[model samples]
Target: MRKLAALTTLALFGLSGAALAQEVTLRAVTSFAEKTTYSRGFERFIERVNETGKGIIRINYIGGPKAMPPFEVGNALKNGVVDIANVTGAFYTNVMPEADAWKLRQVPMAEVRKNGGFDYMAAIYAQKMNAIFLANFVGDNPFHLYLNKKITGPDMAGLKLRITPVYRDFFQAQGATVVQTAPGEVYTALERGVVDGYGWPITGIFDLGWHEKTKYRVDPGFYTAEVSALVNKTTWDKLTPQQKAILQKAGEEAEKEGVAEFAKLNAEDTEKQAKAGIEAIKFDAANTKLFLDKAYEAGWAGIIRQSPEHGPKLRGFFSKAN
Candidate 1:
């Protein structure tokens, strides 16, 4: 009788252990194509998570923007259509307006993580978008204006520029006519003269073939470029504590690694740009200051206008205190 009782207890314990060992799989998508430099950070994060997470959790990475439109990734997350998304804050600003502050961040993400800004931003994502604001995977690069026509300075009067939310206000502040479009449409926009130029980071022009039509890159780029990891709040809440820790740890490591790697890629892309016959249109010191001033003022003003409550707090956390 004692032996039979012990055997029954052991059998129940074995079933419980099997249940605990069942792996969690998460579906993920990126905003850019897989090979593009913009998606490299998310790729690395997925790699780290798969390797370290082991049977605890595994990310089932869906294809990049090909799987779903970039603008729709946020909605997919909100509506529980996917478990995770490797998207940019700019891409999801429709869900959380204060997200634009991320592109305007003046400090390193590591610093932001330490100074309570990271948690604050995470809270905003949860409350506003039903998502978790994971670590920023790309932030070391800055956005520059790539133009088909050479401009003497920052006076953008009468020029039509392709704009993303990342620089819409800045371009408007510089007096350019802004034309918002998807990344895939930029080539047609450029080829057909729908736009004379577009705002983009240092490394992605060639990937998008914008370098083929682009003639000049204006120097003294205004604001930083950033892409982040965003997890669906429902998915995040459902994760086991161990799985959550693994994902969080992988994000921190990937963020640090990505920032360093992308910086090197930025340097290489600069040479590639020059080799591709794209010239630089550098602004003089006075014009540089005027240009930067206009960019930031317009950027923050737009943020404040859109998000009356969270805008100033975001500025305080991300910018140097006055």
Candidate 2:
């Protein structure tokens, strides 16, 4: 009688362990702080996933470098330190040379979002990173010029400007001395005269307080920043067909909300910037044409020349999307 009782308890313990092992927990990491619109969108995605997943899959979010740096998120996801991550493809140009293709086309974010460019990019990402593509969020606006002093088209000649790698060629082509600074150091660099001007997304000027130190902004909006959220391939493959369908549906809903929110917030913030006393210059038609002509030529040429191997494929994608 005692042996039979012990056997029954052992059987129950084994069943409980098996059930617990089946529960899936996903860890997601991002470099953006929780307050940023990008991070907020991600949170909404997590909420949708949780609701749709029905407790079979749980996502645990870890935001910002306080958890991991933006650049490191890719490796973290790749190594399984985090099951998923939000990463900027441009940052990984060195690791994946073809990434430069993203910067090549001067395509508008709205066009890309509406025309399946995001899906195309997702396919490339999946092939290169061994990850499952989920969703992409376009920032509020395009990158523009912020100067510490008054500057116009011709006046921009010989100005020292701080820029990221992708924008370096664009600035250099415009006759500015390009200085590379880490994103976190831009504000201090501007204050210290380390750079006379900076080029970044318009919304970032207000977010990072660069507007306070900058006196002029050019409205020749150049490029949009694209942010992507992805999950580990191995983990994604483990999901049931129904589970995948639910997550994909949640992603589509999240994308719609995000795109709408971004458009609304961008208009509001543009007005706020004007109220904040920075002069916003709208380039005249001639200037606009000149800028676009020069930018497209320089941007596309640089990418093709620098990354000839992947340039054809990228151009094909951009041509179809554009």
Name the candidate that leads on TM-score: 1
> Model 1 segments beyond 4 Å from truth?
1-21
Residues 2-47 of candidate 2: C-alpha lDDT, one tens digit per residue? 9887668768775563354355788998756565645667777888
TM-score, model 1 to reference: 0.94
Give the TM-scores of the predictions, in the order they appear.
Answer: 0.94, 0.83
The lDDT values for all models are 0.86, 0.69
Each candidate's clash count: 0, 0
Off by over 4 Å in 2: 1-11, 14-21, 103-120, 319-322
Model 1, position 301, has a per-residue lDDT of 92
Q: Report the Cα lDDT for residue 42, model 2.
A: 76
lDDT of 1 by residue, 173-267 (tens): 88899988778789999999889999998888888788889999999887788887888999999898999999999888878887788888889
